[model samples]
Target: MNNRLRTTLALLSLAALAGCRGDREDAPPREFFPDLDTQLKWTPQGRSEMFEDGRTMRQPPAGAVPFGRRAGVSDAAWASPWASERDRFLRDDPAYFDGTSGRDAAGNPVFIEKLPASVSVDKALLLRGQERFNIYCSVCHGYLGDGKGTVGVQYSPVAADLNSPAFLVADAPQTKDGYIFNIIRHGKPKPDGSGGFTMPPYGHAMSEADSWAIVAYVRALQAARSAATPTTGGSR
Candidate 1:
């Protein structure tokens, strides 16, 4: 209670306060952080965080997602915070395939896209189709639509016999055109009798016009195969 005692106590209190402040300076205070008004400003870890019940703060599990959300897949939730990473390695990115506008930069299905309607039996287009098929499709469907390609048998589910009437060389070329387009555009979701999945949709690699070109060529090839059935196969 005397002057010296009082002075000593005040100095000790000040020293303790300074020590606490120094410790705080080294590491920002975390104990009191939760009580702050998080609604006003969010720190780096708070931007995409969600509050389960307005109190329980939750973050998407690392490599996890919410309901109706694709965590880290090609077809995952695009608007999620971590989408770019998902697409980097997908065998087929849906964004790259779907939501396209055959004309516009982004596919929106806005205008009457004419790619399917525009294709014809142009020799050049048909030739292009032939070359492309030889490279992409022939490995499985065989050069003559027979399910005899080496790759076809390698698959767990063998490829379909394209020469079959249900699929190939239909009596009417026009009817076959649309069917062929569907096969190329969406691919056979289920391979016929065979188990191997059909080729993924080529609607990404080639334009719709090119798809029809390929169809036309296949139809022509089918006709040729039928006409030249000498019990001999030399490839049309």
Candidate 2:
């Protein structure tokens, strides 16, 4: 055979042998690049010799403001320096945090009488409120906000009827928007005093804005039902 033909046959035989790699159980495969084997990175807490400080983690520069901090924000939004617990509480407005309307001259705790100015009653807010209410609240309060939800029916006492005039009044009102907001933020208190949760607190689950949205959606339901039904004297 010619030298070229002999060389070609040898090369073809080697190529055929390479193709049989990893075909048998005893034949372990090997990677020329081994990309995956070398791709692992050091964890945050892991030590490294790359820096003089010997830290894989990076430290923020001095006086660097945290993400999303607005310049000249309200004092209530900012934390006071070296403030005590009582002092911090005093700094926070009761209407905003605890959802209270302060006190009456008789030394009784007065619940909120109106909705906060911060809550806008526009279409967008109402829609968002409705969406949140249906997802988190409708199972307990019903889509109509009539406290006839399936879960509530299983309980000894049904959920609070948001359509009730005592809570959601039309021409005249008694309960404040803050009262409803408070209820949504911190669930209803259980009578047993077991210290176990009654209605699960959504305050930890949802944002303050989302809780207010639910309140708005509830008011929307009330307004819709009241509009549909005819009223006789002061009774519905």
Question: In candidate 1, where is summed lDDT lowest over 10 consecutive residues?
Answer: 109-118
Clashes of 1: 5
Residue 144 in candidate 2 has what lDDT?
A: 91
Flag regions of model 1 displaced more than 4 Å.
1-117, 168-175, 191-198, 228-236
TM-score of each: 0.42, 0.53
What's every prediction's RMSD, in angstroms?
16.1, 15.9
Write out the backbone clash pairs for model 1. Answer: 99-107, 100-107, 101-107, 157-195, 157-196
lDDT of 2 by residue, 1-236 (tens): 69999999999988987887757755456566687776758889999889889899989796443333335333452343423233334545566555567877997656666555656778898889888888888888888988888896666567767788787444333356776777787777787898655565678777766777777777777778878566569945
